[model samples]
Target: MKLENRRIWITGAASGIGEAMARQLSGVASLLIISDLNAERLLALKPELEKGITTVDALPFDLSNRTEVEKAADKVLATYGGVDLLINNGGISQRGLFYETTEEVDRRIMEINFFSYVVLTKKMLPPMLAQGFGHIAATSSMTGKFGFPLRSSYAASKHAVQGYFETVGLELYDRGIRVTVASPGRIRTNISVNALSGEGTRYGQMDPGQAGGMPAEKCAARYLRAIRRDQWEVYIGYNEILMIWFKRYLPWLFRKLALRVGKV
Candidate 1:
């Protein structure tokens, strides 16, 4: 819908695509409750965005922290009266062989990428349903559509979101809860550096594919348009968009092509 006067809550708002989205949407959104684990970086956005918007606030909390996330929901409700839209965009990634990956690595990925979204969504549903109107959009990944090398756990989490949200969207359709799952391909973000390594530390490096991916600002614009239109799903990328169709109608071909892409 029109973001003008819309009260939107976006997670992972400290950096990357989330940060870009907050900056671009500040002009249109009435109350932007920007949230992330890094309060300093969230404040860094103020200089870039504060000139045009009066209703910007930085909410620092770890989504992986269940109690903190729930408290954030309560804080949002108390502040804006209600959240018109909940953007479950906070998440992390993983890389390396599944066997080589530690249990903690996998758990952390699921905790941040999957469990956090579910918990936050559950908390927001009551308020949204009470209002009889709300939009929930998530930043899933192209990995959600297909499996890739060195991303078994990360892919699983994203796939879970696609399945859960798609079913919930239909189940809650009559309730006026719109759920849109955004699947973006390699975007120019610090995801690789921020991704969990097999040893549970930050991956600390950027992959060639991600380093040469789409700009975060442009990706944010594309995603925001999809949210405006209330699309069920939106895939962002140059050639990566084709992967969705490949996975849909030609699974074998997609797999064969993926083998050549060198890790996706």
Candidate 2:
């Protein structure tokens, strides 16, 4: 479970939390293969990451494309022999009310957030199973655990991630593959702008709530610790960390408070 000198593949490495993780893990990993839709950003990061770690490569492709993911998975296996860790972090977000959100918007969220993860995991599982050792880490959200208003589709997609991976973790536990799900509260990332709007369009704006959230590097460090320890789940945030407890023990109060805070 130690990250040092490990062979790792991280998606969504062009920016935000993924970018931070790539930077932090760069010094720790022996070979790092990063991917994202932003070719330019990925290229830009190469030099910086190389300064931290000698071996850093970036693969740019739309993860929503199953063909692209399959090809990428093949390349990773062929080149690396096998991946020690597969971080399924590439995903989009949801915005606006469910009723107001277009069907296309819902579909888009499901595609990037759920289907992409499923397909990528499916393609990688065989290699991991064959190797008999691998780590699978995903970036879920607090909303994944507790539903919120104006974000039904987003919440649902993340919930699906948790459900699918949690089951997969148990099924693969005896086989030596480890799965860790992260339910992070609001963090300083570009998720708002990347989120699909009500009309199935990009929001093209950042929310203040996200802007004021925890630093990306700090979150990345914590995630590294979780992976090193092979923790099953880790919740990240300030005061909002308590939401996990409330959601677990006081469902009625949690629902009421969540309703007052937003919608449920």
Candidate 3:
């Protein structure tokens, strides 16, 4: 599980937690592949990240596009022979009521947040299984554990991530493939501002809670620690993480508090 000299590929590396992970992993990994939809940002980040890592490759592709994901995966396997770690962190958020959101918006969110993870993992699994050693990590949200207003679709997608990875982890644990499902609470990221609305337009506003959340660098540090320890599931955040406990042990209270919190 040690990161030193490990070959790693991380999606959503253009910003937020993924970017922080790239920066931190660059110093430890022997070969680092950073993927994102923002080609300009990924290209700009490559040199900086390369200064630490032995090799850094910037791969830009839209996660929602299945064809693009397959192509990227093929390129990685063809060139590098496969990676020791695959972090499926590319995803989009939602900020709309269930009744108000369109089916297309829900599908789009699921496509990026849920299906993209599966596609990448499926394409990468053959090599991992052949090598009998690999690590996969997916970024889920606090909403993945429970629910919240204005996040119906987002929560559903994250919940799916939780279920899928947990099952994958169980299935592959005996085969030397480790899976880490990271359920991070609100981190100081632009997820809210970039969240899709009911009409599929950008929400374009930052929530107060997100603005005051933990720093992305700190969150990324915690994530790496969990990975190093080979933890199956890790939750990273401040007090918001306690909500998971409340939901598990005190569902009634959790429901009450959830209602009181209202929309973000």
Candidate 4:
């Protein structure tokens, strides 16, 4: 779908891919609603984005908190009536072994990465369905397609996202609603550094792979392109995306390589 004069709401807009998307859509989208947990950062970004033709609104709330997410969604719907595009991009990552990770950590990750998206989408669905036209784009990870070490919960959450959106996409295809699930391999973001550990604390370290991954802006561009073309699934990354093919066509080789590369 075309972005021009479209009303768009993007979560996780304080940084990384969401921020890049907000910047890129500034002049194109008629109304831009940027949501994030960081109120200061969202407020700071609002002015920069509003300099263009877009009317920018910053919505700050904790995605992990169901009540907060609901309140935020209600506010958005009440204020804008509805949006043409909803990007569920706010999510936390995991960086602990399954055996070592607490159940709380897993639940927390699911709350942010999976449940939050569901809540927001459900809240926004009524209006979109009433209008019979809207696009929903979500940021799933490469792990959504296949498993990897040190990302058990993260992968599970993303897999859930992938399944949910695919089903939704199929159901909404003929109803004038579109869903785009973006499985970005790795973009240069603070996901790793902010990932939860076994005990639920921050991992606080950047993985070498993430540091050298594709730029967030590039990933955002690819994601938007996929949405425009009404593509169901789009993978954005460097050579790491090749792993998805290996897992699909050569499971044994994929397993071997996964074991070897997962050690790092």
Tens digits of lDDT, candidate 3, 9-80: 999999999999999998799999999999999999999998654699999999888899899999999999
Native-vs-model 2 lDDT?
0.86
* Top of the candidates by lDDT: 4
Arrange candidates by lDDT, descending. 4, 3, 1, 2
Q: Which stretches of candidate 2 lie over 4 Å from their true place?
A: none
Instruction: Assess every candidate by TM-score.
Output: 0.95, 0.95, 0.98, 0.98
Per-model CA lDDT versus the true structure? 0.87, 0.86, 0.93, 0.95
Which is superior by TM-score, 1 or 3? 3
Candidate 4 Cα lDDT to native: 0.95
**Any residue pairs clashing in model 4, and if so which?**
none
Candidate 3 ranges beyond 4 A from true positions: none
Measured on C-alpha atoms, candidate 3 has an lDDT of 0.93
Q: What CA RMSD would you report for each candidate?
A: 1.5, 1.6, 1.0, 0.8
For all candidates, the clash counts are 0, 1, 0, 0
What stretches of model 1 exceed 4 Å from their correct place? none
Q: Ten residues in a row with the worst lDDT in model 3?
A: 46-55
TM-score of model 4 (CA atoms):
0.98
lDDT of 1 by residue, 117-223 (tens): 88888878888899898999988999999988889899999999999999879999999989899999999999999988778878889988889999999999999
